[model samples]
Target: MNNNFKMIAKTLFGFEEILAKELRNLGASNVVEGVRNVSFDGDTGFMYKANLCLRTAIKILKPIHSFYVRDEKDLYRKIYDMDWSAYLTADTTFAIDTTVNSENFTHSLYVSQKSKDAIVDKFRDTVGRRPDVDIKFPDVRLNIHIQKNQCNVALDTSGRSLHHRGYRTATNIAPINEVLAAGLLLLSGWDGQCDFLDPMCGSGTFLTEAAMIACKIPANINRKEFAFEKWDDFDEDLFDKIVESSLNKTREFRYKIGGYDKAPSAVRKAQDNISNANLSEYITVERENFFETEKYTEGQLHMVFNPPYGERLNIEMETFYSNIGDTLKQKYPGTDAWLITSNLEALKFVGLRPSRKIKVFNSHLESRLVKYVMYAGSKKAKYNKTIKE
Candidate 1:
């Protein structure tokens, strides 16, 4: 029996490469990359591991079927023919999410409606009952993809976006996303060899993610639940073993991880969230404007943050960015500073050239993750050629 199957891990834009790397590191074979997604071969246990450990994945889906359909009717026929009993019972509720790029399908709702109709119609004919649809919390999540005439149906293994991480309870203005924070850390070549800082740490998202990476803690160790747990095939004992194994691999981190924010409320939120993540022992939060703070550590420091983007670059935002560059150039030496912002105009005000600029999206906003390296005893920063578009 071929227990190994193909799984697709969905990520935000610009994370495909890192997600691919993570999958490969997790012992996934036949790894392949697609737009905003990474596909690989893994067993059921590996699937469980991925849901528990992967930091950059927003969702992990197991593709159950793919077929060619010329019209909506063909879609209904194909779905109606699948053995739904193998995956769901008549009492199991489900929700369908459809993504379409076909000329014939202009309304995604219609596509979802048609698919739901087929699934429920099949159950009614076979079992004399139909499962209810619960959009908020479904027992199973159905995914539909249509590119031209091809359709791929998949089972969403991750219920909510993995960013839920079940940790962050506080948020400041423009706090960065968890998956994005982890992806940004990875993009900045962070490997936990040095101290880390998020000077403008709004809600301490970067701080918590950094600690998890530093200690090799599973990203979702704090997450409440996964969609896979709701599936009929869920194995409680296996999941417990996986959790225990991941926790056993956690290493002690000696490096300093600190966060700072100008606002008192922000500092409190950061502290609360850090405690929620159970990283209070390894991380610290303070209320200090970064402009007034100097390097507290004598060793090399790894800094990552999301400074305010000035609402797309008003004068105040430009000044904020300039102060950031000034503080890094004048006060902080032996630091590798990285940040992400959609405000390109304010970015130029940072003054220091970035060694790397990556194209990524923060929700719908197009953004870039830029890195500036400030050398010890040198006022200027080292950087790669500018990649701004």
Candidate 2:
């Protein structure tokens, strides 16, 4: 049996702690969290599981080598001296992505260039040929990190971001990232225990991700490929076994997962995406305006979504947010609602106090994931009273 080794899972800012928790729950050893990243110990099969199951992770990397370097010459020498044959061959295509935080190497592009040169040159010197570079779809994707005089090289196991999930073929203007959607759901302590809803369900990303989580479905079950499949030692049988094993672990989900959007077009797109994800049997999308709708499920419901944060402070933003609060308080009793937005002022208009406020990012915008709980048999959501026109 293979002994345990360390691997790093990179995530969005503010998700490291939750991702670390996920790793711990997945049976990772020596789990540690860092800024936008988490480090943990697992064997080869566990590495496969982490790649296939971790939703918050953008990429999973296995460190190949690390050492100190003074300049580009030293970088090339050390990299060229390593046994590249163990990972790649002259016939294979590869890509190098470099990140540098040192004054000595300000340009990451040059670092990638130099590192690629060393690898290719080493292959030519040793095997009388060179490997080809394939940036679009590489056989092996390598990562180079240089911080001052220290350097670390890692293999990218998940070629594309794990957020791809290979399910979302339809998208609207502001479709949320799958990883962010899943992370926010996990942050809300959502399990399969309760019903769920995404009121402003543009493209139905939140609903789909929530259903997948609730059912314990493998996060990447729909993903087309993983970088490990392209490696020299790619284990097809082992991967098939892992996939089967993971699929067998899926739990039954009895509760409903629902979504709504006022725009018929948005509802149509959400329905299409949900069908593409093959979750139509489990998720239902409709065209009802959230303000006019009430809780459909009789038991406790979990709500999470992204509402429009008016960029220009339009009156509709205020009305929309306020309507969100009013709907929750007036109609949806025994529910916990969580929404993320960058518009702090607009969020204030909602009026209901958020039980939790977590800092997160939607792409480049700084945002907060805020939650409001309407206890069972309690009053509906609270919002600021409006004056008549």
Candidate 3:
């Protein structure tokens, strides 16, 4: 029997391409890209692997049903007609998450309530008992998405966002999201070819993520649990084999990854988290002001960081940004520096033209990922003239 089925991996804004590429690399078939999501065909073991290995995916959903509905009554009738027993038992708890973008369903909460009622009513009518709803820790999590009049119901294979990699127990002030950090590193072309640095490293998110990417480590190898583990068809032995296979694929990374933060507390927290991820051997955290630091390595460097967007920092934005540009232009040569920030006005103060600027979102804030290329020697002079204009 062919056990293959279609699945969708949801990702952050501007990460569909990378997520699709990741799925393809993971041996997925029929990979197709969507807005903020990628769809592909995989078996049950592949589903487990995707949950454990995909770095850019926020959630992996296995869509079960899709239909057009005119109103709530139509939705309830359709849901009630389906066989919920395949996914849930009378004793198994479940939760529903609904996202509605249609005139018929204005409130998402109401949609979730109706869907829950339908599922429970179906169970009670057929099996004489209904499963209790456990919102926090459900055996199965369902996703409902309504676009206009079309509704798609899916099983959320990932319980929480995959960003909860179970490695970060401590967070400093304004720590970047793990998924976003990994996506930014991938976007910056960081492939472990050179030394890496996050000058303003907060909580060492970039450092840990960069290390994992460089070493080809499974992204969620540190995750404590996935929703699919609670499924009735979950095969523990198959999952174990998949994990072992992925681990065997891990390659050695020769380049060094380092992080620098002026705050001692941040440095300590970063070190602790890196240890938690078992990556201390590949990464180092130090307490040093980025403005006072210079590039010590003679080889090429790849840097990606997110500086304070001035919401949490009290420093002058223009001077801070200008110093960043000055440090790169004068102190750092043969480096590619990339940073994401929501403060567009402050970015102007950097005084260097970004070689590439990609629009992305850090949660709700509209942000830009800007790249600066600092060439060596004669090329440095030409690059200086290019930025001067």
lDDT of 3 at 270: 95
Q: Where is the poorest 10-residue window by lDDT in model 1?
A: 380-389
What is the alpha-carbon lDDT for the whole of candidate 2?
0.90
The clash numbers for all candidates, in the given order, read 1, 3, 0
Write down the worst ten-residue block by lDDT for model 3: 374-383
Q: Candidate 2, residues 1-389: lDDT per residue as tens digits?
A: 65899899999999999899889989999999988899999988888899999989999999999999999899989998989998999899999988899978899999999999999999999999999999989999999989899999999999988999998888887889999999999998998788999999999989989999999998888999999888877778888898999999998899899999988998999998888878899999989889899999788899998998775334488788888889998899889999999998888889898999999999999999999988766332233222322
State TM-scores per candidate.
Answer: 0.95, 0.93, 0.97
**What are the lDDT figures for the candidates, one per model?**
0.90, 0.90, 0.94
Question: CA RMSD for every model?
Answer: 4.0, 4.9, 2.7
CA displacement after TM-score superposition, residue 326 of candidate 2 (Å): 2.0
TM-score, candidate 2, is 0.93
Per-residue C-alpha lDDT of model 3 across residues 1-389, encoded as one tens digit per residue: 88899999999999999999999999999999999899999999999999999999999999999998999899999999988888999999999998889988999999999999999999999999999999999999999999999999999999999999989999987889999999999999999889999999989999999999999999999999999999988899999999999999998999889999998999999999999999999998999998899997999999999998987767789889999999988988888999999999999999888999999999989999999988776586877888999
List candidate 1 segments past 4 Å from native: 312-315, 379-389
